[model samples]
Target: MRNLKRLSIGPIDLDVAGGEIIALTGPSGAGKSLLLRAIADLDPNEGQLSLSGEDRNAISAPAWRKQVMYVPAHTGWWADTVEPHFADLSRAHVKNTLQRLGLESTALNWQVANLSTGERQRLALARAMAHEPKILLLDEPTSGLDSENAARAEKLISEIAKSGTGIVFVTHDVAQAERLGTRRLYFYNGGLHEAAP
Candidate 1:
């Protein structure tokens, strides 16, 4: 991120190396999610963002977004069934991802209407990883999950990060930050205070 600024947060210049996880923690309105949104280019923000040294403006929005995926807390379910939401993925791939997230392979057959909030959260994460984004922006990915499911989510994401995808996530859970963050940034006084990785 270079000179990235948006919504009370800006001029954020940092390098998120491949295979690193940076956790953003702070009180409400401190712009933790806003900062993630800026880096992902989901919100209107000034400055530049580059991945592997490539400028963000050089690519189309859709293409750039494909590489830097942003997973919102509540993912949109435009289709009635889970399979349709992942129409781009083969059944095998979806099933593989389902199992990776601790769901049975047959979970692909479930209806979206029947999924609980936690299910949606996990499924949304699965969807995000399907494209293999170089940068993964997760907005409180495990807020809806119980401890077991949350741990499962963390493990899955950790695997992704280890595989060389940079991860930037927002979490209010300090323990979660300690567990998952390779580097932690505490948002305070409308600014960020950095901590060692």
Candidate 2:
């Protein structure tokens, strides 16, 4: 993104190379989520964004969003059952993702209302990964998980990036940022600044 500005953030310029993870950290209301939303085109903002050198404005919003998937912290679900929220679970990759997240395949058959907060977060991530996006904008992806599940999530994220997905994730855990970020960015005073690795 070049000169990306949202609400009170930016004129920001950033480039996330393939297989890279950029970790965002800051105080609450620092516009961290706003930056991700802008990049995903979920919120109105001024910017020039491109994917693999293709102009963002050149493609339709839905198409741009498909390639650059955004999975919010609390992902919205419109269905009563978990299966409806995702693509065909028969796919090997989808099943693999669920297993990797420590979720049983049967979880897909359960009611959405019955899930725990951490389960919801993991399922949301699994659903997002099913699309096989080139870039992922994640907002506090593991905030709801316990230590074990959080470690599983971090490993999965690292594996995904290794497979060439550019990722931008928001997190409060400084250690997690260091563990996953190829580069770390700190949001402060209405601007994003680089942080030491």
Candidate 3:
């Protein structure tokens, strides 16, 4: 894929591609999330971002969102139970995703208020993946989980990437990036620099 011309986000410049897992890593306040937001068109900035050769400005916001799903670091659950949130999805698929993420089926019925941080993170991921968007933008997806659960989440992400979904994962964890990313984009000094393979 060809890298687009550098796009400006605040004071940063970034050029990236879709269809591959591009990990954004750097110290805090390096604008990793800002870069993702710019691509999502959630922020007003002077830059050009295109997906599958379609210019970002040419598409409706809702249309862009349908193809590009962004999962934030902290997810909010507005419903009392998870089942209702996933009601539109197939029960079997929901159950399988929960199981694969190391969550119990019973958690689907549990009150959202009662879930732990890790549980909520997994649920958010499941919710995002239920729609099977072509591109996924994730921010610190495994930060809330323990080592084992984190590994499970990573494996699930890997599997999703292998299935041909483009992923842009933002994380500070070097090992997670190394494992999940086909390419690495280091965000520093308000710009993205490609990392050595």
Please give, for residues 45-108, the per-residue lDDT of candidate 3 as tens digits: 5655667788877989988887788888998777888788898888888889899999888878
lDDT for each residue of candidate 1 in 83-146, tens digit (9 for 90 to 100): 7778787677777877878888666689999999999999999988888899999999999999
Better of 2 and 3 by lDDT: 2
Question: How are the candidates ranked when ordered by TM-score, highest leading?
Answer: 2, 1, 3
Model 3 has an lDDT value of: 0.79
TM-score for candidate 1, residues paired by index: 0.94
In candidate 3, how many Å is residue 21 off? 1.5
lDDT of each: 0.86, 0.91, 0.79
Q: What is the lDDT of residue 88 in candidate 2?
A: 49
What clash pairs does model 3 have? 12-190
Best by TM-score: 2
Can you give the lDDT of residue 148 in candidate 3?
A: 95
User: Which sections of candidate 2 miss by over 4 Å?
Assistant: 88-90
Candidate 2 lDDT (Cα, whole model)? Answer: 0.91
Rank the models by lDDT, top first. 2, 1, 3
TM-score of each candidate structure, all chains considered together: 0.94, 0.96, 0.87
The better-scoring model by TM-score among 2 and 3 is 2
Weakest lDDT window of 10 consecutive positions for candidate 3: 1-10
